[model samples]
Target chain A: MAQVTLRKLVKMYDEVQAVRGIDLDIADKEFIVLVGPSGCGKSTTLRMIAGLEEINSGDIAIGGHIVNDVPPKDRDIAMVFQNYALYPHMNVYENMSFGLKLKRTPKDVIDGRVKQAAQILDITELLDRKPKQLSGGQRQRVAMGRAIVRDPKVFLFDEPLSNLDAKLRVQMRTEIKKVHQKVRTTTVYVTHDQVEAMTLADRVVVMNAGLIEQVGTPNELYHTPATKFVAGFIGSPAMNFLKCSLEQAAGALRVRVSDTLSFPVPADRTQRYTPHVGKANLLLGLRPEHITETRRHTEPNQHDFDMKIDVVEPMGMETLVYFSVGGVELCGRVNPNAGAAEATSMKLLADLNNMHLIDDATGKVL
Target chain B: MTDTAIRAGAAGPKYGSMSRDRRWALRWSYFFLVLFAIFFLTPPIYMFITSLKTSAEISAEINPWWVFNPTLGNYIELLTQDTFLRFFRNSAIVSILVVTITMAISVVAAFALARMKFWGSATLATGVFLTYLIPETLLFIPLFKMFAWVNETLGIQLMNNWWTMIILYPTLTVPFCTWIMIGYFASIPKELDEAALIDGATWTQTLTKIFIPVALPGIIAATIFAFTVSWAQFLYPLAFTTSTSELVLPVGIVTTLIKGDVFNWGQIMAGALLGAAPPLIIYAFLMDYYIAGLTAGATKG
Candidate 1:
C-alpha cells in the first residue's frame, strides 16, 4: 500500500516549463487520472512520480517517507509504457517473471506470481508466446501482467490504451478497472482523453499548460467546474458561451444578451454579484441539454431566444438542433418527436432554472 | 479524316511520350546492375583462374582469362610449405584475438555512450566514430615510433611480430564496431529499459538481460565487420612483420612467392586466392548480417 505525494513539483525543459509547481496527494488504492490536452504535463507529472524522470525541483513522498532520491527500482513502482515496452525477446511467462528474477526471487515463487498475474489478466494461455506473436491487445495484457506480477506499491500507466484501436480501447478500459479492483494498487494513470478520465478515475486532475487547473471527483468536474478551461474541457460537445451583461431593473438583477434574451438572477446571488452591475460583462454558460425547444409562444417569457435553426441532427433517440445567436452557433438536444427541422425559424426556451452564469472576465460559476 | 480524329483524341502532349520514357528508365537499371556485377567479380574470378595454372603455363604466352594447363600444383605447394602455413596461422590468430577484444570493448563503450548520458557523451561518441575515419596509414608512422620508444625506454619490444597486430587491429575495429553497436542499441526503445529498471534491475542487469538480447542483430553485424576487417588488414601487418614466419597472408604471398627478382606468378595468385577464402566464405554465408550492420544506422538518422 502506498500513498504518493508531490509537493511543489516542477519540471522545466530548457526555457519551456512542462510541469509548473504541481502539488497533489494521492491516497492509498485511489485510481487518479491526470487528464488534459497534449503537452499539458500530465504524463511528465506521472513520470516524475514513477522516478523514471529526475525530479527537477520538488519533494516526492511515497507511503509517508520522502523518496526524492530513490531510484525507480527502489521506489517499488511498476510502470506500463504507452508502447507496452514488453521485452520482445521474452515470452509472456518470462516477461512477467523478469522483475522478480532480477530481484533473485526463488524459482517456484516466481512461477506462482507469474501464473497468478497471468490468470488475472486472462493471459495464462499466452504465457509461452513472445510479444511479437501476440496481438496488440494481448501484448497490452502482457505489459499489465508484467506490472501485476511485481505486486508493486504503485502502478504508473502512461496512456496504455493509446496504442489500441477504438473497440479495444473501450474493452481494455474496463479491464483496467477490473485489474484495479482485484489488486487495489494506488495507480497514477495518465491520458489526454477525458472520457477515459471520466469513466476510470476516482478523482480527475484536470491540467492545462503546466498547472493543475482543477482537481475533484469526475461528477464534480462535470457538474461544477472551477475555471473556464475546465468548464469547456470536461463535457462532451462542450458548453456554449454567449457574451452578455448584468443589469438591474426594478431592483431585480437580470442578465441581458444584446436586446434579445434576458435571464433574471435568483435573489440569493443578487447581492453577491450586484456591485459591478452593467459594467460587469458576464458570460452566459449553458449546457446543450439545458437549452430546450418551446411550442408556439408561451406566457411569462423570462428566458427565450428567436434563434434561426441551421442544421437538424436527429439521433433516433434525440434530435440535436443547431442554431445561431448573434453569429455564435449553439447546439441543443431536443426530443426527437418535437419535429426540429433545419433551415427554419425556431423559438428556443432557455431553461433558466438549470442555467449556469459564468463571469466573463474570470470563468467562475456565478 | 483519320488525322482529324487522332488530333481530336490527342488533346495533351505529355501522354504520348510518357510510355517511351518509362522504357528507357527500365533499360538503365538492368544495364548498371550487370556492369556492377562484372566490375566486382572480375578480380576474384581472375585470381581463381591463375591459381589453377601450372608454373610453365602461367608464364607462357596464353590468354590471361584461361588456365591453359590446369593444375592445383600452386595450391599443393603452398599447403605443404611450413612457412606458408605459419602465415595463415598467424593471420587467423591475430584476427580472432582482435575480434574478441574489439567486441568486448565496443559493446561496453557503445552501451555507455548510447545510454549513460554523462558529460560530453555526445562529443566523445562522435570523436570515437571519427577516430575510425582516420586511416591506419596516417597512424602507422606514429605507432611505429611509439613502439620503438617503448622498447628503448620501457624495455619492451612490440614491433615485427603477430602480437603487434593483436594490439593495433583493435584500434581499427573497436571504434567502427562501437558506432554500429550504438546504432543497434539506440533502436531499442527507451521504454524497454524503463520497464527493466522498474523490474528491480540495476543498470548492468538491464544491459545484459534486455539490451544485449534485443541488440543481438547489431552485435552479430559488429562481430562480422570486425572479423572481416582484421582478417584482410594489410598495411599494419605488412609494415610491422617482415620475417617469413611472422608475415601474414597478404605480404607472405608477395615476399616468398618471388625467387630473387623473378616473380612466381602462379604460386603468388594461388596464395592470394587461399588468403581471400575465409572472409569470402564468411561474407557469403552471413551477407545479410554484413549488409544490415552497415545500413542499420540509416534508419536511425
Candidate 2:
C-alpha cells in the first residue's frame, strides 16, 4: 500500500476545465472517498490519479514516485468501473487471471491469487462461467476479484455500486467496506452517494464544479461543515437554510426573520457573527434532527417556537414535519407520538449548539 | 341491464375490427415474403437445373424447364479437368490471401482510427469511407497505368501473375473492411480498453488479447466479404492476367468455357455453381455473426 499525493492537478478538455488545481494527500492504507454530484470532477480526479487521463498540469506521486509521464499499466493502480467492464468472452477465472498473466506471473501463483480473490468475493462457483451468464451482482464481484488479484498499490473505484439495484447496492457497499478493511490498500472511491462516502471513507472529500469544497473526517463534516454547500450536500433530507438578518436588539444579538419570529444567536457563536451585524441576508442552517419537539434536552442556548404544521410524514422510527418559517419551507424531525397533524399548531425546539450561521453572499459557514 | 347493453355495444366493433386488421396484416406479410423468396430463389434453381442437364438435352429443342436426359456428365467432366482444377486452385489462393491481408490491415487501421486519437484521425476515418465509395471501375484504369509505369521503370511485370491478385485485392477490400471494423471497434465500450491498459497490457497486446477476441465476429464478417469479393472479381483479373494458368475462377470459367461464337452453357453453369460454393458454405455457417457484425455499429451508436 502507498500514499497517493496529487499537487496542483489540473485537467482541461479543449476550453472546458474538468479538474481545476486540486491538491490532496491521500495517506497510506487510508480509504478516501471523493463524493459529489455529476459533472463535479470527482471521477475526472480519480481517472487522472489512475493515469487513465492525461494531466494538463499536475504532479501525482504514488509511493513517493512521480508518475506524470507514466502509462496506466505502470501506475500500480487498479480500478473498478461503474459498468463492471468484465471481458464478455472470458470466464471468471480467465478475467481474474488476465492481469497476472500479463505481468508474467507463475501459473501456480496466478491460480492461487485468482482463487483467493474469488473466495473473498464469494464467486468461487463462477470461475468457469462467462460474464454473460452471470447476474449483475455476480459480475460486480468478478470485477472486484479482477482488481483484487492485481494487488496494486492503490484501488480506484468510479461509482462501482451505481449500476446495482438499491438493496444490492447497499449490500455491496458494506461488502466493499469489509474488503477494504481486510485488504487495507490505499483506496480512493468516487461516488455521488453521500451516504456511501460517509460509511466508507476514512476521509471524505466533497467536491463541487471542478473544485474541492471540503475535506475532513465524516464526523467533522457532519457536525461542522466548512461551507453552505458542504452542509447542504452532506446530509440526507438536507440541512435547511432560512434567509434572515442579524441586528442588535436590547444589547443581545437577535436574528430578525419577521415581526414576531426571531431568536438569539448562541453565546459562544455570537462573536463569530458580530462583524456581520446589520447584515440583511445571513442564512440560518439547521439539520432536520436538530429541530425537535421534545424540550427536556434543551440547553441555555436552545429556544422554543410555535409553528403551524403544513404536512406530517411518519417514518416509523421518527416523524418528519414540514412547516413554513418566515415564508421559507423548513423540515423538522419530531417524535412519532408527538401527534403532528397538517395545518395544526405545534411547539418545536431549535438546538442552537448545532446550528450553522452562513454568509449569504459568500455561502460560507461563519 | 341498460348499462350492460351500452358497454357491450361500445366494445363490440373495436375488438372485431382489431382481429380482422391483424389477420389481414399477417396474410399480406406472408404473401409478400413468399413472392420475394420465389424471386430470389429462381436464378439459383435455374443454375442447378442447367448444371444437371447434358449439352444434347440443352439444345435438343425440348421443353426448356424439364431435362429429358438428366446427367452427371458435366460435373464429372469439370471435376476431372486439369484446367478447371487449376482455376479453382488460383481462386482459392487469391481469396484466402486477400482475406488474411485485408483482416490484418483493417484491424490495425480501424483500432488506430477509432480508439487511438491522433491529429486528423476523424478526417482520416471519413477519408477511408470515402475511398470505399469510389468505384472499382473508376480505380482500375489508374491502377493499370501505375502497374505499367512500375514495369517500365522498376523492371517488374505485375500484369499476369496470380499473386498480383493477392496484392491488388486489398485495394478493394481494405477500405470497406476497415470501415466495418471501425464501426465494430467503436461499438465496444471505452472502459474495456482502459481496463485492459490498467491490467498491464500494452497497446499491441490489448489489440491482440482483448480487441481481436472481442471483435472476432466483425473480423469473421470482414474475412467473408473479402473472400467473396476476391473470388468473384472479374474485371481486374480479366484486364491484368491473360494466361489461363494465372486467371482466377470467375474470369477463367467465363473465358475458357466460351470459344469465339460458341457458348458452352452446360460447363459454364457447372463452373459458376462450383465457384459459388465456398462463399455459400461460409455464409451458411456464419450468417448470424455476419448479420450481428453488420448491424453492431448502427444499433450501438
Candidate 3:
C-alpha cells in the first residue's frame, strides 16, 4: 500500500530551476513513467521522489508519511541508475544482498532473499562473477535484482535502458515490464524515449522545460493531448503543425491555410472555435497517420487537399510522404503502393475531426 | 618479359630493403633498451657487489664490479647491532603508521571534495593540489620552529622522536594522495553513491562499503605512495631528529655508517641497498596499480 504523493515539489540547482513545483499522486502498484526530452526535469522529479535530491520546498509522502526531510535509506525506496551502479568489487550475489546485509538481516534470510531475487531476475548462474564480468544487459538485470531483493516501497529508475543498444533496450524494456508485473510495487521510471514510456508505463507524465505538460494513460495522451507541446512531444516522427488563421468566410468558420486552400471547421468543433474566428497565427496540429492519403475508409469529416511532395520515405508497410503547406513541412503516411514520389503532386487528406487547433501565442489547444 | 615477371622484379628489392630497415629499427630499439637497463641498474648492482666485499678488497682496486673476497661480514655485523636493529624497527613503525594516517585523512577529505559540492569545494580541491606543490623544504623550517615553540611553551618534546616522522610525513603525503583519490572518486559515476544512499546506506556506509571497495586500486596506489614517501624521506628526519635511537632509515644509515671523515663503504652500501629493497619489492609487485593511480586523474579528468 505504498502510494507516493508529491506536493508542490521544486528543485533548484544554484540559479537554474530544474524542476518547478510539481504535484503528482501515484497510485499503489501503478507503473508511471515520466518522460521528456533531455533536461526536461523528469530525472530530477524522480530523484526527489527517491530521496536522492533535496526538495527546495515540497512534501513527498510514501505510504502516507511525509519523507521530504527523511534520508533515502529511511524512506525505504530503491533506485536503479542508468549506468547500473553495481559495486565492481563484489560478485552478483554480494551486490544483490548488500542492502539486506546493511539492515543486519540474518545470514540465512539474506541468502534466501538474494537467491530468490536471482531466480526471479534469471541470474542464478552468474552469482559468483563480478559486475565487470557481466555484459551490459546482464548488469542491468543485476541492478534490478539488487533493487528487488530489498523489496522497497517504491522503485525509481533513472533512464535505466539508455545505455544499451536499440535491440537490447527493447528486450530490457519488456524484462522491466515483467519485473514490475511480478513485484507490483509503485514504480517511477524516467526516460527520454516516448516509445519506452508508451510501451511500459501504465500512465505517462509528459514533462517539458521544468513543468509537466500532461499526465494520463498512454492511449489518452496519444489521442487527447492537453497542450500543443504534449501533442508534438508524445509521438515519434512528431506531430506536424501548420501555421494558419481561423477566419469567417461565406457565413462558416474555416481554417484558412492560404489564398489557395481553406479547410472548413468540422461542425462539432465550430462551437469551440467560434470565439476565435478572426484570429491569425493559429496552429493546426495533426499526427502523421492522421494525415494519410484519401481512402475509401476515410472518415466523412476528413478534408482532401493537393500537396507538392518534397520527399518520399518508404518504410515497407507504409511510406512517409513529405509535403509543404503554408511554408511548413508536413508529413503524411500513405500506402507504399500509393505511387507517391518526389517532385510530384499528391492528394492527401487531413482528418478535421481529429485535428488540433492551438493558439500560437499561448501554445494551448482550443 | 611477362607482366608478372616484370612486377616481381621491380618489387623484390624494395620489399627486401623495407624489411632491412625494419630490422635495423628493431635492433636500435633493443640497443637503447639495454643501454637504459645498464644505466639504471649499475648503481644498485654496484652497491650489492660492494656490500659483498671486505674492507681490503673495496679499498684495493680490484674490479669495482666484482667482489673478490665475497663475505657477509657487513650483513652479519649490522644485523647483530642493537642500534641498527633499532633504526630498522623505527623506520618500519613510522612508515606503517604514516601510511595508515595518510590513507584515512586522504580518503575522507577526497570523498568530501570530490562528491559533496559545497560553496567552495571546487576551489578547495584546487587548493589541496596547490598545497602539494609547496615543497616540504620550505615548510620544514616553520615546522621546526613550531616544534621548538611547542617544546618551550607546552613542555612536550615533539622533535627528536622517531614518532615525529609519523607526524611530519603525512604533511608531505596527504595532499598528493588526496588529489589522486579525489580524481578516482570523481571518476566513479555519481550514480553508485546515490544508489547506495537509496538502498539503506548512510554517507559513511557508502564510503566504507562502496567507495572504498570500488576504489581499491586507488587506495592501494595511495598506500604505496605513502609508504614509499615515509620510508625514503631524508630531509625532514635530517632537519628535525638527531638522536641515535630516534632516527629513521635514510638519515640513520647516512649518519651512523659514516664516522666523520671516515666512511664505512661496505656497511653504507649494504644499508642503502637494504633500505631501497622494501620500495623496490612493492613497486615490482604493484607497479600497475601505482601507475593507474598516478594517471587516473589526468586521463579521467
Candidate 4:
C-alpha cells in the first residue's frame, strides 16, 4: 500500500499548458479518479504518475519517495491503457505473467500469481485464449489482470473502460471497484465520464482546463461542489444555472430570476446573501433533482412555481421535464407519475436548501 | 392475395436477371483468365518440353512443341557435372547469406526508425527509401571501380569471388527490406511498446519477444524479396565474378551452357528450370503472407 503525492506538477506541450502547476495528496489504498472533459490534462497527470510522460516541472512521490528521473519500469507502476493494450500475440496467461517473467521471478511464483489474478477476475477459463479471441469486456479484464499480477506499488488506468460498450462500461466500472476493494492498491484512474468517476473513485478530483477544481468524496462532490464548474459538472442532467438578481424584500432576501418569477432565499442563507443583493452577473444554480413536481405537503425552504413544460422524457422511474425560465432552459426530474406533458404548465417545487448561488463573473459558488 | 402475388412476381424477374448477369460475368472472367494464363505460361511450358528433348530431336524439322523422344538426359548430365553443381552451391550460399544479413540489419534499423524518435530520424527514414530507388545497374560501374581501388590500397582481393556477390546484393536488398519493415513496425499501436516498457522489458527484449513475432509476415515477405533478387541477379554476378566456379546460377548458365555461337539448348533449359524451382516452391507455400505483407501498409495487419 502506498500514498501518492504531487507537488506543483506542470506539463507544457510547446506553448499550450496541458497540466498547469497543481498539487494533490492521495492516501494509502485510496482510489483517486481525475475526471474532466477532453483535453483537461487528467490523462497527462496519470501518465506522469506512471512515468510514461515526463513532467515539465514537479515532484511525484509514490510511497513518500520521489521518482523524478526514474524510468517507468523502475517506478513499480502498472498501467492499463484505453485500448486495453494486451500483447496481442500472447494468450491471457502469458499476458498476465509477462512482467514477472521480465523481472526474472520464479516460474512457479509467476504461475501462482497469474492463476490467482485470473481466478479473482473470473477469467480462469480464458487463460489459454489470445486477446483477439476474447470479447471487449474480457480483454479489459485481461488488461486489469496483467496489472494485478505485477503487484506494483500503484495502478494507473487511463480510461480503460472507454472502449467498451455503455452496458459493459458500467459493468466494468463496478468490476474495477470490486477489484480495487479486494486488492486495496493505490489507484489513479482518469476518465472523461463523471458517472464512472463517481462510481469507482474513493475520492474524485475534478479538473478543468489544466487545474484542479476540487477534490472530495463522491457524495461530497455531489452534494456540495466547491466551485461553479464542480456544481455544474458533478450531477447528471447537469445543475442548471439561471441568471438572477438578488433583491431585498420586507424582511428576507429574494432572488429574482425574471420580471414575474422570484424565489425567496432561505432564512439560513439570508445573512450570507445580504451583501449580494442587487448584484449583477449572479446566477442561481439548482440541480435537476432539487427541482421536482409539487407535493401536497411542503417542507421548509421549498417553494413552488408554475412552468410550461417544453419536453417530457419518461425514464421508467423518473421523468425529466424541460422548461424555460426567462429565456434560459432548465431541466427538472420529477416522479414518472407526475402527469407532465408537452406545452402544459405544471407546478414544480425548488428546494432552496440545496440551491447554489454562483457568481457568473468568477464562476464560483457563493 | 392478388397484391402479394404481384409483388412476388415483380421481385422474381429482378432476381433472375441479377443471377443471369452474374453468370455471364463469371464466364467472361474465366475466359480472360485462361487467355492470360496461356500467354504467361507458354515460355516455362516450352522450356520444360524442350528440356525433355535430345539435341538431335530439337535440330530436326519436327513439331517443336512435341517431344518425340522425351528423356531426362539433360537433367542427368547437368546433375553429374561438378561445375554445374558448384554453380548451384554458389547461388544457394550467396542467396541465403544475403537474406540473413538483410533481415538482421533491416529489422533493427526499421525498429529504431519507426519507434525511437530522435534528431533527423524522419529525414533518415526517407533517405533510406531514396537509396532503394537508385538502381544497381547505374551503381555497378562505380562499385566495380571502388573494388579495384580497395584491392590497390588495402591489398585485399575483393573481386571474382562468390562471396563478393553477398556483399553487393544487400545494397540492392537492404533499403527495400528496411522500408517494408518500417511500415509494418509503424502500424503497431504506440501503446503496445509502452505497455512492454512498463512490464520491465528492455528495448532489445521488446524487439525480440514482441516486435519480431508480431511482424513475422512482413519479415517473411522481405526475406522472399531478398532471396529472389539475389538468386536471379544476372548483371552483378556477371560483372563481379567471371571464373566458372565462382559464377552463380543465372550468370553461370549463360556463360557455361552456351559456348561462342553454339548453345546447349536442352541442358540450358534444364538448368533454368532447376534454378526457378526454389522461388516457385516458396511462393506456392507462402502466397497468403506475401499478399498480406504487401497490403499491410494500406490496411491494418
Question: How does each model score on TM-score?
Answer: 0.92, 0.95, 0.92, 0.95
Write candidate 1's Cα lDDT for A42-89 as tens digits. 999988888888878989999988988898889988998888888877
Off by over 4 Å in 4: B1-10, B287-301
Question: Whose lDDT is greatest here?
Answer: 4
Which prediction has more favorable DockQ, 1 or 2?
A: 2
Q: Considering chain A alone, what is the TM-score of candidate 2?
A: 0.97
What docking grade does candidate 4 earn?
acceptable
What number of backbone clashes does candidate 1 have, counting pairs of residues 3 or more apart or in separate chains?
Answer: 0
Residues B1-301 of candidate 2: C-alpha lDDT, one tens digit per residue: 9999989977899888998999999999999999999999899888888988988888888777777778888889999999899999999988988999899899999999999999999999999999888888897899889999999999899999989989988988999999999998998889889999999999999899888888888888888888888889888898889998998889998899999988888889899999989999988998887565322221111
Candidate with the greatest DockQ versus the true structure: 4
RMSD for all candidates, in order, please: 4.3, 2.9, 3.6, 2.5
By TM-score, the best candidate is 4
lDDT of 1 at B68: 65
lDDT of 2 at A238: 96
lDDT of 4 by residue, B18-92 (tens): 989999999999999999999999999999999999999988999899988899999999999999999999999
| Candidate 2 per-residue C-alpha lDDT over A1-366 given as tens digits, one digit per residue, 9 for 90 to 100 | 498999999999999999999999999999999999999999999999888889999899999999999999898999999988888778889999999999999999999999999888899999998787778788888888999999999999999999888999999999999999888899999999999999999999999999999999999999999999999999978999988889876667887666888889877777878898987668989999988895767788778999999999999999999998778899999999898999999999887788888997898898
Q: How much is A120 displaced in model 2, in angstroms?
A: 1.7
Q: Which ten contiguous residues of candidate 1 chain B have the minimum total lDDT?
A: B292-301
Report the C-alpha lDDT of model 1 over B52-136, residue by residue, as the tens digit: 9887877778787987678888889889999999999998998889999999999999999999999999999999999999998
* Candidate 3 lDDT tens digits, A118-158: 89889999999877677889999999999999999999998
Q: Model 4 chain B — which ten-residue stretch has the worst lDDT? A: B292-301
Error of 2 at A218 (Å): 1.0
Task: Provide DockQ values for all models, in the order shown.
Answer: 0.37, 0.42, 0.42, 0.44
Worst 10 residues of 3 chain B by lDDT: B292-301
